[model samples]
Target: MNSALEILTKYWKHDAFRKPQEAIIASVLEGKDTFALMPTGGGKSICFQVPGMMKEGICLVISPLIALMRDQVQNLQNKGIKAIALTGGIHSDEIIDLLDNCQFGNYKFLYLSPERLQNDWILERIKNLPVNLIAIDEAHCVSQWGHDFRPAYLKIVQLKEYFPKVPFLALTASATPRVKEDIMVQLKLDNPQIFTKSFYRDNIAYMVFETEDKLHLLQQILQKNPQPSIIYVTNRKSCNETVHQLESLGFTATFYHGGLSSKDKEKHMQLWMNEKVQVMVATNAFGMGIDKANVKTIIHLHLPQNLENYYQESGRAGRNGDKAFAVLLNNPSDILHAEAQFISVLPDKKFLNLVFTKLCNYFQIAYGEGIDEQFSFNLNHFCTKYSFPTLKTYNALQFLDRQGIITLSQEFSEKITLQFIIPSKEVIRYMSLNPNDEEILLTMLRTYPGIYDMQTAFNLQLIAKKSNHTENEVLSLLQKLKEKNIIEMMAKSNDATITLNEIREDERTINRVSKYLEAQNKLKTEQLQAVLQYSKDTKSCKNKVLMQYFGESLAADCGICSYCISKNRKKQNPETVSDKIVELLKIQDFNSRDIQKLTKLPKDDVIFALQKLLEDETISINSNNLYSLK
Candidate 1:
């Protein structure tokens, strides 16, 4: 432990291991199968990383999130640790080279996506590597009942046979007991050490508001709360809509969702991280590896599919242990809409069969011939061409992924740049004729690596702008260099990573998977309705009810929520009109403009209400900013 902290200080700046991290690290080092249930900021990665540093062989980490894998690998490299994530989008030769590096180059960690388990050649290569530990991130996905279960996770269990002596460690931030048990069964853990952190977060206040006008309620929360907040809506369009609304309401807002281009997503994320954007309106796709510690609030415009998702998103707030609020804005129709979304994705067997045949046709493979072909799909365009419902077709594809028909990875793209292939001496010799051109060429050589290995993809316009040359000049120079065998260049296209299975699935198999998916969708709809039931319960504390749903028995009333406030005010006032007025004010401050925008009520009525408030001095408005008694 002394050497550990010394290395930690020498490299990572921290002197002590976070709570539960040391124990998990020690267990893994002792060659024990460990299952860790820690919160978001609980230092889960250190449990495997520290032990990997102390062990004799590499630790192969299986993660389900590509963005998370990229971020963690980059961070590890930044700390001078050797780590690699062999996910989709890379060429097959690159994967083979990385595997060879892991086996012979003394790489300590090789992070892989779960879908990569389907690659038999890669598995064969990994089977020969000296893997001391297998770490599975987001282990809850093994459970069918879990919120984000991926079918590829089940194939991970086969690696246990390849390395019988190696210990397996599973980790997840959110899971019910059922999910935990499913994880154990899926991984085939043998009396593994199970560690669970208490789910109770005493510092975060949970609040839910029932209202017809949610945008106004959202504005009120933002005005009163501190910065570095997140607002979650149901879809990409809603994320944009909410951001526009907030911007009009005089707040700095940016939107994010999976549908955005990778460059756009990264730009928005960087802006938010730099505090240039005070609030982000996004779908649930954001915030897996985002580690901003001072987020003060999370507002949900629609109910999440389950508590696991809600908890994971809300947990992003108050990570620095300060006070924060997790508020949900709900209307009666919101639950119905969420339910409809769940139902829309349950594909019928007929559609599933159609998708299977269409996929084979599109790839130009016969029924029995698509064994080793790799192809990318555009789901919306594919469905539009075939006249199938897009959402239902996507669901069917997911079912196919589950049935081992094909691997459908979530969409991801990254900005990668590289430059020329000549040795420095020859380049310098060529550049000695013109010092200015030599300087620019030498600058490219010094800044980027792996330039000589293959055709380099880079932005020609940016390079020309920096070099003060025309785009045509740059192109001609690059072309001349390539013809001289001094460089090779290939720009990256918008390519999706995918691998198809060898066997064509029969109609029977498709039908079986479809039935199972439909059943699962039905269960999800029911669970969502159950959460809505808890939300509508007026007799219980909102926090207590939510905690109880996650199996907490002694959870108490949260005194700050709408239900609690309403109860206390009802007992004191005994006047319905006064309580209604106060609740309405909590939703929004009504001035002439707000009233005119919303209601058909006469201006006299609105003016009378404002005068009454001014007379009592209970509220005031000036220059569109509203205020209540401080």
Candidate 2:
């Protein structure tokens, strides 16, 4: 076997490991379990991947994030490494074939979703693979106490029975002490060597600006910051609105959300990634697996509900160890609105049951009739039909899915893509052989080329229109074609994939997870309060606050933070009234006395504000020495 360093240098072209990576890899190579708590951009993948490359058998990676898996797999493949991800919506036969390839096909890595572990057939097949080390990414999900918990992770511990000798490596960027303990116990990791890199990001200047005019402040920040920044918003409307606001100001900006089609998402992401656009105003969905290193600024327009999310997103910045800012713009309304949207309407038992019943009614599934059945759920249609708040109802569905009541995937089918497994002549022959499915098949073939060799992205609506069929008809035909092997279709995922986990029961049974729901609600509230406190905090060093939240410590204040800089500025100036006035004057033309009336500052402060504005040349003193825009 090649040494780990040799494999790393050979594939990654790196002569050195990033901080704790070497030690974590050493533990895995020594056949000892490990909990690697590296930061978001801390080269977590290299820790497990290098060891896997050096090992004899394939590394089995259990990831909860589909996007992460896809990105890693693509990156590996780009590096001439053999890796495959068995994500959702895959046909069983394809999964078996992929697993078989991993076993005997010399595949280096296998990335799969945690949900896939529930399949008995898959487990049986996994037993046959020469799996060396099992690496669980996002291991925090196993901890119900963690922010992004997934119950499917509880089933991962059973792997020990099949691969008793294989070492386990659990990796996460954000996990509290409680979450860490839960992960070790739940995964049954055997005396794992725990490696935690210090959470102190000395290079990141943590900033919290309490401002009522967030948009104006945002514009100012954009003007000051360098290119290729990210603006995270709370909702789709805000994302689009921010993009529009930036565009109106002549900035190259775009928006991304889960609602966008796969092509559109990829296009927008690529545009931003390639720096074709200077900024990407996106929801929480846009930043995983991004390693652009030079993200100079990340402004959270709304307060993140928890520090974990804030830390992870902030960690995205300053990855290059250069000066970067993780800024949160908040006002009284921002926090209050965040609380109401995130915590208040978290769907109690009545609300959950109401949504659940409406869901059943909408699907026309009678009680006890739709067990294990699947349906394409459109949240907008359901909410419009029942006149429910989109966000609250969606959160209710998520909670239900978490409780194993139903499975809701909002963008599942949107990522589903397909390719023709056969040649064009064979496709035409098969089209001739089957008269009923020709239109859709021909439409697909005519619509996209290179489908024979690679996965081609597809749109059911477009295909349906070209074939003169409804979306359902197009989907059924595609699946039927896939079954016949004329074309291979990725399992459809765009609609909410709702699997009635159990036969539809009455309100009493559906609300059985009420206590669990209440606990979740409580946890969510606590999480919100934690972030709120962080936002409201003025006495603590921002870096210290973040470090303590993650159970770490910093030797001293990161001097680059807003608070530390403000303190130093205060010591130097002792009076900031002039600075505040300059800010408003820069926004528009304002005479000094009018600025005083608008700002209601003392005469001395107003004179100071005017003098500062003139000195800074932000506003010119006219013939009368009154301040005006330069």
Candidate 3:
């Protein structure tokens, strides 16, 4: 058998194991239950992969993130290692074949979701495999206290009954102290060897700036740094808008969001990864399994839902150990906006019951049935039919998904393909004859520049909005054009797929997870409050604050954070700040905000300097409220 180090070098091409990885791998190899709490970018995968390679049989790895699972499987395959992931959207026959291969094909690893374990046939097949180690990625999901708790993770402990002697390795990048305890309890690890790496990244300078004009500040920061960076926004609309803003300012940037097609997502990701674009403006969906080491900056234009998300996102920078920055741009209005978007949309028990009942009724699922039944789901149509609030209904469905009640698949959603069958001149003539279709046709032409040449998958919602018509109206018009032979159109009207994982019991089903629902809602609220407090903080060291939150203590302040830098600036001679303000006034009229930006001083110090300059008669306030030299 190859040794752990030999396997690592042979497969991963890394000569040395990072600190603590060797020790954790050794524990797993010794047949002991292991728990690893490493920060993001800490190479947690190596702990399991190396040990799994050294063992004789295939390793069973379970993860909640389908994308991450696919990514790791692809990476391992690219390295000539045998690996397979049984994710969603796979045929049952193929799954059986994959499982059989795991049994007889000399496969080294099998990756699957925790939810897959609920199937008795899958469990029986897994029980028959010669599994050497059971690796659980994102192990924090097993804990109810975790930020992303999945009820399916509770079933993971049943694997121990199947493989009693197999050592289990559980790993996560973020888990609070309570969550850590919950993970060990829920996974039922026996005498688990625990390894925790400090969350502090000395190379990352955490920065928080309060500004009303975020775009202006963003421009300044990007211009000054000009390195490969990521700008995080809250939604798809903002992602595109920010990219446009950056491009207009002569910066190369691309955007990524959940709404993008898989092809577009890969295209944009490659553009940023190859440095064809200097920046990637994206939502939180962009960073999983991404290992770009030289990202110099991670800037958040909107407040994250919680500090865990912020830490995970910001930690993406400076993975190469050089100096980097994690910047958060906040304003007073952001607090209210975040609360509205995150907290207010949380569905309670009653709401969940309502959503579940309506969903079953909509699908025509009889009571105490509907297990394993799948249906194409049109969220907008359902919400419109029932007059349900769209956001809350979506949240309720997500809650059902997390609770293992239903499987919601958003893959390949919102796809509308169209191609002009007639010549462009004939299409224009048809459009002119049909005045009502003229606007929508023109909008489609402008939005998809290549529609005349080839079949194109376009965003129906975007076309509806751009054409100033309802989506139904746009679809109707497109259908008319298609019937007239003006164009060929195929619209996948369903935006998601819903699979019933359990029988429809309506209130009884919701009552089963009521306590968990309440607890999770409370936890989310507290997490948001903590994020708000962190953003409003001005005195504490940013690194120390983050470390303490994750159950680590720092004796000394990190001198690179925004707080430390401001503290050092305050110790400078007061005359220097006053001199800078005076020089700016001599050049032109200025306000306190303008002076603060130009002089790179804090607002308080800028105000103080301006007051002193005015008292000394070296500067005077003009009628326009701008300070000028007297």
Error of 1 at 68 (Å): 1.7
- Give lDDT tens digits, candidate 2, residues 95-139: 777888988899999999777777787888888889999999999
lDDT of 3 at 495: 57
Candidates in order, TM-scores: namely 0.78, 0.80, 0.84
- Model 2 is weakest, by summed lDDT over 10 consecutive residues, at 566-575
**What's the number of clashes in each of the models?**
1, 5, 0
User: Which numbered prediction scores highest in lDDT against the true structure?
Assistant: 3
Give residue 626's error in model 3 in angstroms.
4.5
Best by TM-score: 3
User: What lDDT tens digits, residue by residue, belong to model 3 across residues 1-630?
Assistant: 888889888888899999899999999989999999999999989998888888899999999888788889989999989999997655577799899899999999999988899989989999999999999999988988899899899999999998999999999999999999999999999999999998989899999999888998899888989889999998778998999998999999999886666668899999999999999999888999899999999999999998999999999999999999999999999999999878999999988898999999999999999887777788889999999998789889988888888888764465578899888899888878888889988999998889989999766667897789987798788888888888888767565778887788998899888889998999999999989989999989999988888989999999999999988874546799998887777788987768887888777777777788888998889788898888
The models' CA-based lDDT, in order, is 0.75, 0.83, 0.89
- Given candidate 3, what's the lDDT at residue 145? 88
